[model samples]
Target: MHEMMKAIATAALLLATAMPALAAPAPVYDERPAKLADATGVRDYERRAVEIPMRDGVKLHTVILIPKGAKGAAMLLTRTPYSADELTGHGSSAHMGIAIDGYDSAPDVVAAGGYIRVIQDVRGKYGSKGGYVMNRPFVGTSLNPTKVDHSTDTWDTIDWLVKNVPESNGRVGILGISYDGFTSLAALVNPHPALKVAVPMNPMVDGWRGDDWFHNGAFREYNLTYIWEQVATHDNASHYELPEADAYTHYMRYGSVGALASAHGLDQIGFWQKIKAHPAYDSFWQEQAMDRILAKAPLKVPTMLVHSLWDQEDIYGVPAVWKAMKPADKDGMLFLTMGPWFHGQEIERADSLGPVHWDSDTGKWWRRNVLAPFLAHYLYDKPMDVATVTAFQSGENRWQKLSGWPEKASSAKLYLHADQSLGFAPSDKEAALDYVSDPANPVSFMPRPNKQVGYEGNPWPTWLTSDQRPVSGRPDVLAFTGPVLDKPVAVGGDPVVHLTASTSGTDSDWVVKLIDVYPDEVPMDQAMGGYELPVTMDIFRGRYRESLSQPKALTPNVPLKYTFALPPVNHVFLPGHRIMVQVQSSWFPLYDRNPQTFVPSIFEAKPADYVKANQKVSVGGTEGSYIDLPLVSAPPAE
Candidate 1:
C-alpha cells in the first residue's frame, strides 16, 4: 500500500511540474468603470505629503501615491502651478469632480498601475508657497537668467521625486496639459538624472507672439473664464470652483462670447494688463516666450509633444516648439501628436479614447507604451517596443509615423496672383483690389477676443473674425489671388510671407493671410459666417519687420520686403476651393495699434501719431513680392 501511494504522489508531482508556473500575472489592475469600485484590487493605496525642495529654496507642496503591494515599480510625475493641494493631494479627486465624473484621479491611474505617482504644486500657486507669476515663461536665452521659474522649478521637482519617492525605480516621467503642460516642459529643460520622459499638451510657451492670449499684439481682455478667475478669484486658489466656472455659475456668464466682460463687470483682465504694460517685444515678452529657450533645453530622454490643431489657445505653439527643438535632439526621440480637439478636450470633453480613427486613447497609450516602458526599462528592468514620432493630420483624420518632422522631400510653392483668386501662377495684371480698415470696425482674417475676453473669444457674434474677406475686395486691403487649380491641390506646411512693397506712411503693419476660398457657393451660416476662411495668417508690424527683436520704421514708399512666418498648417484644397492671399495694414487691438508714424518703438508711438497709411502689394519688375507655401503629400493615407 505504501509503494502504491508513493507511485501516485510521484505521478501527481510530475504532472504539476509539466504545467508551467505563472509569475503572478502582473497583478491585474481595475481599469474598467465597474472595477474601479473593486477595493480588493484597487485600495490599499499609500499616500503622503512632502514639501519638494527646489534649487531655488522654494518648497513646493506635493502628494505622493504608491500602489498597494506594488513597490520597486517605476514612477510618473505630474507637476502643476495650479494647486498641488488639489493636483497632488486629495482635492483633485473625483469627489471634487475635477479629476473625473464617476472615476478616479491621475494618482488613481498610477496607483492602479502598481507604480509611484508624484503630484507637486509648482512654486507659486495653491498650497505651495510662492508668488503666482505665470504670465512670464522661459525660452533658452542668455539675456534671461535662470530664475525660480517653471523650467528650473521643474528641474528641482524631478530631482526630489527621483530621490525621495521610495520604490521609485529612479526613472521618472512627466505629464500635464495646458498650464500644467508648461510645467511638464519645464522639467525637460536640463533634465535630471532620473527624469526619463515628458508630455506637454496645449502648453503655455510663447505667450506674447502666437498664444490665444495675445494675438498679433492686441489683448484678449474679455476672456470670460480667466476674467472670472481674475475678478472673482484673483490670485486666490480658494475660488477655483469648477462648477462655478460653468456659465450657469450665476448668470454672470453673458449670452454670447462678446458679452461676458460687462456681465462680469470687469473692464480688463491681468493678461491684457500685462500686454498693455509691455508695448514692445522687450524682455517682458522675450523672457516669457519658449522659442528662445527650447534649443538650450536639450532633450535628455525620449519626449512626446502634443497639441490640438484647433486648440484655440496654443494652435500655433505645438508645431513651432516641435520645429524649434534642435536637430541633435531629433534622435528619433521627439514624438509629436496633433488632434482635431482643443485644449484639455480629452478630459474636459470626456474622450479617453484617441481621435476618430486612432482607436487607442492617446494619453493611455502614451502612458502604457512610451512613458511606462521607459520607466520600466530604465528603472524596473522591463522592455518595450516604442516609436519616436507620430502625428495626426486632421483633414486626413489619420495617424502617421515619421522619423522626423517636415518629413522627407515634400515641397511645392503656390504664389499670389490677380483678382480674389489663388493658385500656382506667377505675377499677373488683374488689377489690385482694396478695402477700408476703419479703426473702429477693422476687418479680421481670424477671430479675436470677445467681451468674455481671453484668447479668440471675440465678443461679437461675428463669423469668428472672417470679415477679412472684404480685405481682398475692399479699398483698404490689397488683393493677390492665385490662379484656379486644374487638379486637386493641397497645401501642408509653413506659410511664408514676402512683401517687397512699401507704405505711404512712416509706421504701419503688414498683415498677410493665406485663404482657402471654399467655392463661392459653400453657403454662409447666416451669422458671422460670410467673412474669409483663413487657411493661414501672419502679420509684421512695419517697425519690427526686419527683426522680431529689433525695430525699424519705413521711409515712406521705400519698398520694404517684409517677411512674417505664419504658423505651419496642413490643409487640403479640393477641386473648386481656391487659395488666396490678402495684404493689408492693420490687424488692430489684436496686434497692438501700430503708431503709423514709425516712432522709435511700439512703445514710443504716440496715440496722436496713429495715422492712416496707404500700403501697396504690387507685382512685376522691382516690386516683385509673393507668399511661399510648403506643400506636402504622402505617408500614403493611413
Candidate 2:
C-alpha cells in the first residue's frame, strides 16, 4: 500500500512539472473617467512612510510602495514640493495619489511587474527638514557633500533607497509634472549612478522670460496667487485664505506689487519680495534658470521631455531647453513629445483639451504606448522604438512621429492689411490701424465676472481654449480676420510675428493672439460655430526689444519694427474656418499693465505713472506687418 501511494505521488509531480506556466494577464487599461476610483490590482502591495536622510543630515519625508513580494524591481522616484501624504498610511484613497495618477495612469503598475514606487517631500517642504530653495541650482563636484542642493539631496536619497529597500534591482528613474517636473530636472544636473531615465514634463525652466512669473520682462502679478498658495500649503499642509473673493478686484485695488509686501504683509513671502526687487532678467533670475545652468552643466542621463502647445505656464521652459540641449545631446538621448493639451494635460487628459476633441484618448495612448514603454526600456532593458519628436497635430487629429522638430518646414507669410483683412499677399497701399490703450480701462484677458480667483481655485482647466468673443470688439483690441479658407492651412512649428508699429508713449506693450474662427453653422449645444478659439498668444514689453537687461524707450510715432515669436502651435485651420489675429497692448489681470511713460522700473511706478497710449499696426508698401507661419502639408484624405 505504501509503494502504491509513493508511485501515485511521483506521477502527480511529473504531470505538474510537464505542464507549462501560464503568462500573467496583460495590464488592464482603465477608461479614465472624470472621477477616478481605486484601481483593481494596484492595492496588492505594502506601503509605508520613512524619513530618508540627505547628505546634509536633513530627513526628507518619503512614502514608498512595494509589491507584496516584489523582487529585482526597478525604483521609480518623484520628489515634489507638494504634499505626498496621500501615498501611504491607513485608508488612503488609491485614486487620490498624485504620483499614481501621473505614472500609473493605467492604474495597474503592480500588475505590469510591480516597481518600488517612492514619493518624497523636497527639502524645506512638508515633512522635510531644511531650507527650501526654489529651482535649487546644482552644486558641482562638492568636496564636502554636507553642503548640498537639490541634486546632491536627490543623489543621497537614491543611495539610501537602493541600499535600504528590499529586493530592489538597483535601477532608478525620475519623473514629475509642473513643480515636481522642475525637481526631476534638478535631479538630472548631477545624477546618481543608478539614475537611468528622466521625464521632466513641462518643467518650470525660466521665470523671468516667458513662464509663470514674467512674459517678455512683464511681471505676472495675477499669477502670483499661485506662489502665495504654495507658501501657505507647502509647510503647513493647509489652504490659505484669500484676502478677498475677487482676485482681479483685490489685485487692482492693491495698485502695485510692492504694496502686496508692504501693506498686505506679503513680505513674509520670500519669493515675491525677491521678484519685486529684481525687475529685469538679472543675476538673481539667471542663477535659478534651469536652461542656462543645464547648458553650463550638460546632462548625461537619457531624458524624455513632454509639453503642450497651450500650457499657459511653463510653455517657454521646454522650448528653451530643447534649443539649448540640441547641441550637447551627443548620445541622442534627448527626446521630445508635444500635444495640443493645456498645462499638464499631456498626462492628466489628452483625449480633448477643453472643447477640442481628438480621435483617441491621447493621454491614455501616451501612457500605455509612449511614456510607459520609454521608462520601462531604461529600467528593465525593454525594447523601444523611440522617436526624436512625437507631436500630436490637431485639426488633423492624428499623432505624428518625426525624425526631428520643425522638420524641413517652409514659411508662409500672412500679411495684416489696413481694412482689417488677413491674406497671403501684402497690401499694395500703405495703411494703419490705431487703438487707444488705457491702463485704467485695460482689456480683460478673460471674460468679466471671473469669480475664479487663485490658480488653486480657478476654473482655468480650459482657459487656453476659451472663445475670444469677449475681447473681440473691445476698443483697445485690434482684430485682423482672414477670409474663410477653401483649403486647410496647417501650421507645424513656431509662429513669428513681425510688426511695424509705433506707440504714442516711450513705454508700452505688444500682445499678439492667434485665433481660430469656427463656422457659424454648427451644433448649438456644443457652440461649435463662430467660436473664436485662441490657439497661441504672447506679450512683448517694448522696452526689452534691444536687451532683456536694458530698457529702451520707443521712438514715438517713428514706426519702428518689433519682431518677436509666440509659443509654437501644432494645429490646423480646418476647411471653412477663418484664421484671425488680434493685437492689443494689455491682457490685464493676466499681465501687469506696463506704464506708457517709462519709469526706472514698473514695480515702483505709482498710480500717477499709469497713462493711456495710442498704439498702431502699420503696413509699409513692401515691408508690411505680417505673421510668418511654419507651413506644412495638410492631412491626408480620410
Candidate 3:
C-alpha cells in the first residue's frame, strides 16, 4: 500500500510539471508614454530657450519670447539672478499679455509695441553655468581678475540675440528693478552697439552704502534670508524657514545676526562670509560700488533712472547713480524718474499703498505716458517727448515735470525744540531728550508681529509708508511734532539730518525719520487721520560717524555731531498737516542690533556686548538737532 501511494504521488507531480503552466493573466498596462508631449500651438508668443555663450565660454540660460508673426520688433532684454524661466513663464495663456507678466515684463508695453522679450539668467544662477559672485567685481579689479563681468556677458547676450533672432530689429533695450536694475546699469559700463536704452529702477549701486547689505555702517540684518536663498544654491533651491512667525522674536532669540546665520548653516555661503569679513565700508565694497565705477566713464547709453520715493530696499541707489552719472551725461543721455511707489511698485498696482491713495492709477499713467514712449523712441524710432526729470509729487498727488532733480531749492532748517515740538526756529534754552535703548528689547522697525522681509505676503514694500503711530509712543522712540501748517510746505530735494546726540555706551546707532502728521480729522480717508506718515528716514551707525571707511568708538556720555542725508523727497506738507521727526537708537531686525558696547565687528559681537544705554538728543543751542529741508518755491496751479 505504501509503494502504491508513492507511485501515485510521483505520477501526479510528474503530470503537473509536464503540463504547461496555465498562462498568467495578462499584465495590466498603462498606455501613457513615459513623458508627456510638450504643449504647442496654444501660446500667442513663441517661447525659445537657448544657451548664449559668454566671453569665457560659460553658457547663460536665456528665455526669448517673440510675438507671433512679429517682424522687425525691438528686443527688450533683462539679465537677472532671479530665474529667467520663472519671470517669463509667469502664466500659460494663448494671449501674449498673460504669458509674459512679472517684475520686468511690462506685458502691455511688450504686446502693444510688438517687441521680443528676452530674459536671461545671470552667470552662476538658475540655468547659467558658472560660480556665482554677489555683484561680481568689474574686470581687471583686484577682487576679480576674470575677464567676464556683467558688461561682457550683456554684450555677448545682445550680440547673440541680434544675430540669432530673426524677428528682432537689431536694437535692444534693457530695464529691470533691484538686482536686475543693477545688471541694467552694469550693461552701460561698456554697452553693446545694439543696446539703445537702459532703465535701472531702484538699483543696488552700493552694498555697504545705504543699498542692501549696509546703510551707513549698520548691517541690514533682514536680508540675511535673501542672502541664503540667493547664494546658497545655483538655482535658489534653498529656503529659510522662519522658526518664529514674528521676525522680531526670531532675531532677538539669536542675539546677533551672525549667530542667527550660523545656526541656519549660512556659514557655508561665501557672500555672507565676505560680508562678515568686511563689516566696515572698505575697498571690498568701494570697488563694487556701481555708482562710483560708472562715474569713471561717460554715459554711453540713453538711460533713465527710476527711483521710488519710499523704496525700502534701494532708497540710496537711484540718487547715488544719478549723482554719479549726471556729470557724465554729456549728450543728454541720462534721465531721472522718481515715483511715489515702493521698491518695485511701479510695475505692480500703484493706485495706493496701505491707506494712502493717489487720485489716479499713477503707475499705469507713468507706464503709458513715460515708459512706453521712452522705449518706443529708441527701440522703434517713434517720436517721444518726456521730461528730463519726472517726479511724482506726493501729498497733493500730482506729477511734476522738471528740467533736473533736487531742482534749485532753498535750504531751511527744521529744528527740534523743547516739549517734543518741531519748528523752523531754534530753541532759546539748552535741553535734551533721553531714552534707553536695550538690545534685549530693541525698537521694532515695523509693527510687532513682524513677518519675514519679503515682497509677497509681507508688508515690507509698504512698511515705509505705514502709519508711524504704532512706534511713536514707544519709550525708545522719541517723537517730535511741529505746529500745524497754514499753507503748503514743498520739500523737493534730499533732507539732511544734523544730530547732536550722546550715548552712555561706547557704541550706538541713530535713526532719524521725517514724518508728516495728519490732522485729527480726515474727511476723505478716516484711516489716515492722525497718521504719522514717514516721508524720508534713515539710520547711521555711530562708530562710522567720523568716517564710513573707518570705525571709531564713541566717547561715552559725550556729545558728538552726527550728520547724514536722508533720501530725496518730493512731498508737500499741506495745510493742517504737521511735520514730525522721530529719533531712536535702534531700528531692530531691519538693521542689526548695535550692541551698544563697541566691538571690533558687530557681526561677531558676543551676547554680553549688547547692553542698555541712555541716548540723548540735544534740542537747543547751536549744536542742536535739526533737519535741513530743501524747500522749493510755490507749486504750479493745478
Best by TM-score: 3
Query: Model 1 — which ten-residue stretch has the worst lDDT?
Result: 95-104
RMSD of 2: 15.1
Q: Which pairs of residues collide in model 3?
A: none
On a 0 to 100 scale, what is the lDDT of residue 68 in model 1?
Answer: 60
Instruction: Write model 1 residue lDDT over 170-228, tens digit each, in one string.
Output: 77777777776777777776777777767677787776577756555533332434534
* Backbone clash count, each prediction separately: 40, 0, 0
Residue lDDT tens for model 3, 1-638: 99999999999998888666654466769888889965758777888999999888999999998888989999999999999988877765777777777887778888888989999999999999998999888898899978999999999999999999998889999999999999999999889999999989899899888999999999998898899999989988879878788888888898888899999999999999999999999999999899899999788789999999989899999999889889768789999999999998888779997789988888898989899999999998899989999999999899989999889899999999878898899988788889999888888888788887653478887889988888888999999998899989999999999999999999999999999999999997888889889999999999999988889999999989999999999999998999999999888788999999999998889988988999999988798999999999767646
Candidate 2 per-residue C-alpha lDDT over 246-340 given as tens digits, one digit per residue, 9 for 90 to 100: 65676577676666545655577777777787888877777778888788767788898888888877889988888788778888999999877
Q: At residue 58, what lDDT does model 1 achieve? A: 74
Q: Give residue 99's lDDT in candidate 1 (0 to 100).
A: 26
Q: In terms of lDDT, which candidate is stronger, 1 or 3?
A: 3
TM-score, prediction 1 = 0.72
lDDT: which candidate is best? 3
TM-score of candidate 2 versus the correct structure, residues matched by position: 0.88
Give the TM-scores of the predictions, in the order they appear.
0.72, 0.88, 0.95
